[model samples]
Target: MSSIASFVRGVETLNGWVGKTVAWLALGTVLVCFATVYLRYALNTNFTWLQEAYVWQHATAIVLGGAYTMMTGGFVRVDIFYGKMAPRNRALVDLFGTLLFLFPFMAVVGWAFWRHFWSAAVVGEGSPNPGGLPAWWLLKGTLVIFVALTTLQGLAMIGRSLLVFGGREEFAGTSSH
Candidate 1:
């Protein structure tokens, strides 16, 4: 149990780091957009990296930040069903949800997208609209980034479920939500 607790703590800490990293990345995206706008209008020159940067930078932050949403119980779901359940029952649902639905889906997306991204890299893929952006690396990176963060949060959720059913949760000062 203590080992699980330790693992939960470790996952939680990593999730926090991922969340912060993504937040900063999003902020940078915002700045980049502003720069692009300024460049386009004020300088009379279209920025080359803006389109690719827009897609991947925003996507990267979103991917990296998804785990924080899951771990914090911020994910959109059926509260009508969930809110009525007892703590133990809720834990059960969470455990099942993470294992059966969430993990598999994220895993599959990560797996498939990783390949797509990798292929893009291998082929030196890039936009070809005369002056687009080179961003196969950035786009592909999001596949792992999102999955890794989400997986970490999923592990923490699993740990929380274990705590709940084991009768050790009351002392843990943790809420599955």
Candidate 2:
């Protein structure tokens, strides 16, 4: 039980750190977008790499922050019922949701994205547009990261649910809901 608690804490910590760190990319995306617009409109010039940079940053931030969103309970839910459920019942819902839905979806997406990332890496894929950024494989790899982090968080959720079932809800990590 203690070990399970530790696992939950560890996964949550990792996802929290990753999510917070990647969240900075949102600011970078905005700044880059502003710069791109300024350069294009004010100076009447554009750089493909600059344009693609913001898109990459935006995508990376969103993808990598998924687990964090789950950890913090930021993902949308049909709260009309969920919000009114007892703790144990909520745990049951979370358990089944993770096992029945999240895990399977992650498995399928992970495999598909892994193949895409691998093929891109094998060929050293780059942006197709002239003057666009290089190393498109890096962008594709974010999908793999997304799948991994979300799956790990799902495991943590399962651990939390088990803790609740065992009447050790105190051992559950500080999940938002």
lDDT values for all models: 0.77, 0.92
Colliding residue pairs in candidate 1? none
For all predicted structures, in order, the TM-scores are 0.86, 0.96
lDDT of 2 at 41: 100
Task: Give Cα distance to truth, residue 6, candidate 2, Å.
Answer: 0.2
lDDT of 1 by residue, 37-152 (tens): 88889998886768568766788778777887777666777899788777788888888988999899988998888888788888888777667777566677777777877887
User: lDDT tens digits, residues 78-153, model 2?
Assistant: 8998888888888999999999999999999999999999999999999999999999999999999999999999
Q: Candidate 2 has which clashing residue pairs, if any? A: none
Tell me, by TM-score, which candidate is best. 2
